[model samples]
Target: MKSSLRILAALAPLLLAACAPQQLVRHQGDAASLAQQDAREKQLAHADHWTLQGHLFVSNGQDGNGGTVTWTQNGDRYEFILRAPITGKSFRLTGGPDGAELDGLDGGPQTGPDAEALMRRVLNWDVPLGQLRAWVMGTRAAQGGVAQLSFDDNRLLSSLQQDGWDITYPAWDTTHQPPLPAKVFARKPPFMVKLSIQSWTMQ
Candidate 1:
């Protein structure tokens, strides 16, 4: 019995060493996946001309609005339209490098130098349109530096922290070339925006 115990003890160190190689391989695989993901993000960053139809929900701790949303983007120009069937409220935001315009509101048409400022003043909604342009496409914003990022098992973006917002991608449309986000949720304290994308059209 004493000799048998000694043999088992001697094999324990060898067994542990065998597992070390597997651990190293797993670590290497993770690194490779991250590298691939980074390359994919670079490609998506340049994808500026596309349209997406989705559902958007926004909340500011108390008041909330939910509706069907359609966003069309062409280079730096974009047109965003939202329709709330239950409330019979709707709005359209169209903008480019020159300026921005918001229509279908109480005070009639409103124009400003930027979309974010216009929406904040007219609708009282704190939305980061510039940053969101990239985020909605599953890439980090070009301006604000990202604080952290996490990936799912498929090496797709799972969650990220950037510009004071915690953004998460719960699902992806794997049918696309590089895959696109199907559901995106972003929160910053009292403000939260959730998007459920139904279709994407690339140009």
Candidate 2:
């Protein structure tokens, strides 16, 4: 009985080592996965054409508005529709790199050199719609501006600052290829916009 007990005691250390949790292994694997995800995002930045349908909330110091937003991008040409359900008002914005045009529910077509300026002028909302095309996909816009970017534990974009607006992505839609921001918010003091993407498709 004494010899048997000694044998069991001798094997205890080996058994415990074999059953130890794989914490180090898991952390290393996670780091590799993060690197892969970062590479994928960088490649996805070149994608210029895609569609997104979502909801938007805007506060422009004077008033607050909530509505549905449908945005479509095809190369340099893009179209965005913002509809306010309560007021039954809908606005469509379409444009390219050189300029943009806005069609309000109550006014005629308004053209401008910039989409952000047009929105603020016509809709009384300060929204950076042009930059939002890239922002929604978790990347900085290409119009040449300084952007401060932040990443999550998984090396995914969590927040960014561009053109004086601070943007934050709280959740991501991992169900889609390359994954995109499920919910994003941008604030520049007097102006604030919240976007929630319900669907995303890439081409």
Candidate 3:
């Protein structure tokens, strides 16, 4: 019995050694995946000319708005249009290096120095449109440092914190190379925005 026990103890070390290789392989695979994802994000950063059709829902912890949204991007210029189905209300926001213009409000067209300021003044919603241009594309915003980041099993961005906002990607359109966000949800305390993308066109 003593000899048998000794043999079993010796075999236990071999079993543990066998598991170590698998663990190492898994760790290496994870490292490789993260490297690939980083490369993909770098590539997407340069994808400035693209269009996306999606549904957007925004809430300010009191009032909520939902609509079909179409966004077009051409270099530094962008146009975001949101149309409410039931109310037939629509808003168009266009901006570039020069400035931002918002139309289809109660008053005449509104213009401001930037889109974020204009949105807050006209819509009373504190939305980070500048950062969203990158977040919506499933990448980090170009300007700010990320506070936190989490990845899914597929090594895709699952959640991130930046500029006091917590953003999450629940689904991805893997049919596209490097995949694109299918659903993006972002919240900052009383403000929350959710986007469900239907299609994407890169130009």
Candidate 4:
């Protein structure tokens, strides 16, 4: 269930190989077992509104390129825009990952497949939008049957193992109303997406 995401050049093409420390956060009790408590925590941090800017990429055992995605989540409604460098030109794309609406510089009201195609035209590679948000936030979807979840000293979602996928969060600041992720790592081999939140806006 991967969709194409476009990467901006100024922020793209930086998919160089880099390794980070294998970190483990201590949080007692299985979170999945405490659905109500976990849900409470999610509601507590509560993202009434969230906006972030960063580079994103996906790999399938091939060369990957990074793209810039400016995402803003307003309550349940969201707006996601992507831009990537390809063939010495920059293409802009704006839409919602959960199928909100589409407004692109390329024109035409596009659907999911169409939007994905538009970004691929500029990024020169396919992007996985579904995974992008999950990685950026350092959390999994509420639908995911989380086997276990833990928090770090920062009270941020530190680690999660949902549906056999391992996720790690480092450096989080809830100073924002919706909370902001400093960095997130989603490792599942062949598709390890890492993100660094450059700036955050909460309202």
Tens digit of lDDT per residue, candidate 4, span 1-203?
A: 01233334212212211233356565644545345335544754455477887765544345455566566767655565555545333334444445423444344444444444544554443444443445456545555454466766545566666554566666676675446566665555454556666777766
What range of 10 consecutive residues in model 3 has the weakest lDDT sum? Answer: 11-20
Clashes of each: 0, 0, 0, 9
Tens digit of lDDT per residue, candidate 2, span 97-186? 888786663336878887666655554444556566666677777773888666665656666678876777677888876777787776
lDDT measured at residue 136 in model 2 versus the true structure, 0 to 100:
67
Residue 112, model 1: Cα distance from true site in angstroms: 0.3
What are the TM-scores, per candidate, against the unseen true structure?
Answer: 0.82, 0.72, 0.81, 0.60
The reply for model 4, stretches above 4 Å from the true place, is 1-21, 26-48, 85-110, 113-135, 138-140, 177-179
RMSD in angstroms, candidate 4? Answer: 6.4
RMSD of each: 18.9, 20.9, 19.0, 6.4
| TM-score-better candidate, 2 vs 3 | 3
lDDT: worst 10-residue window of model 2 = 10-19
Q: What is the C-alpha lDDT profile of model 3 across 82-113, one tens digit per residue?
A: 77767666667788989998776565688899
TM-score of model 2 vs. true structure: 0.72
* lDDT values, one for every candidate: 0.66, 0.61, 0.66, 0.50
Kindly provide the TM-score of model 3 when superposed on the true structure, using C-alpha atoms: 0.81
